[model samples]
Target: MARQNTVHAAAAVLVVVPTYNERENLATLAPRILAQGEQFHLLVVDDDSPDGTGPLADELAAADPRVRVLHRASKGGLGPAYIAGLTTGMKRGFDYLVTMDADHSHDPADLPRLLAATHDARADVALGSRWTAGGSTRGWPLRRRVLSRGGSAYVRLVLGVDLRDATAGFKCIRASALAALEIDTIGSSGYAFNIELNYRATLRGFRIVEVPIVFTERITGASKMSGRIVAEALLRVPALRTTSLRPLADVRPLADARPT
Candidate 1:
């Protein structure tokens, strides 16, 4: 379903980018995203970066009516920041909600493809995968590559999910899926949070399709991956397995979920 230019759709798509000390990257990332299409909007969730990313985001938002900002008091975990941004998007009633990295890792150019993939398949979730067919990562060292691909494999193995890139951070999820997820109840953070969302989507009978994307490593800033985050992911994966995740009933179809 790829196209020459951006795939035009009437439904509002909110791209929620979580930022912390990403001032340099955010300055360049915003315009490229807003250029994709008029229907595509951006919500920058800033975690009170010492580098003044919050103010920069405010500047961008002030310049463009489509851009909006949500400022948090401190640097919370990635999962919570995303939850806050996505929760805001949901409350504002966006038809599609996207989770993208701000470090220039997830290409702004791929935004249209993701939107098209989800739209054409009528999927509730569009996973911008690095392990799926035609998907790959760039500017990554062998060790980092091993960790990322291996982590995805491990999550699939332990969770019994068919997702190829289970630990992937870039995704487009419909608000209907978010509503079923019960935004306030989800607590998983970082890579584990991505895994949990995809897992829950499957349980809720949401059709999730993987779209190929070349994930480039960020050159402007330091990596956020820590031993503590890794350990947390290891511990949380199993807890999700043991815990009861009762599927929601009386579920609506894709057509019904779309905004009129």
Candidate 2:
């Protein structure tokens, strides 16, 4: 399916980019996002950064009618920034909202496939998955790939989420799915946020589909991954599973609950 046709089939897609110190990457990515041959808009929610990413986002917004910028007071966690962007997109009447890394790890070329999946498959949420068929990562070191695969595996095994890439940052969410999501109640704000959203969506019975995409290394800037971040994700896995299963507790067990 063509980008234009896919976009028209859904409500206008508003790409929500939460930026912090991404000035070097923003300029090139912003225009490319606009030129995707789709009726999508972009919202840049920038946490105040010494690197001037916020100002550059403002400049981009001024130049492009489809681009908008939101300035946060300080460098907040990723989860809060995304929540702000999603809220803004919904309030502005966008039917679809997408979030992705700003450092170019996510390929703009693959965006059309995600939108097409949302349209053609009637998916409430479309994920750009690296673990699924035809999906792969390029130029990543062995350690990085192992980390990603391990994180995804841990999430699936713990939360019972079958998504190939439970921690994928690249995702397209239908407006109805967003509305159905209890965004405010989500607690995790880092890599764990991706797992939280997918788990919650599954628990709510939303239809999710994955599209394979080649994830490339960011052309600029250093990675934000940290040991602390990884540790936090490990801690949050059980929390997500517990939260997800709590609601279903009222349903009587089909067979007596098996001991772990």
**Model 2 weakest 10-residue run by lDDT:** 248-257
- Kindly report which residue pairs in candidate 2 clash with one another: none
Encode model 2's per-residue lDDT on 104-215: one tens digit a residue.
9897776666776665566777888898877899999999899899989998788767777889889998888898897878888787788888788888877777778889
Cα-based TM-score, every candidate: 0.91, 0.91
Question: How many collisions between residues are there in candidate 1?
Answer: 0
Model 2: per-residue Cα lDDT at residue 220: 88
- Runs in model 1 with CA error above 4 Å? 1-7, 245-260
Count clashes in each candidate, considering only residues at least 3 apart in sequence or on different chains.
0, 0
lDDT for each candidate structure:
0.82, 0.80
Looking at candidate 2, what is the lDDT of residue 133? Answer: 75
- Backbone clash pairs for candidate 1 read none
lDDT value, candidate 1, whole model: 0.82
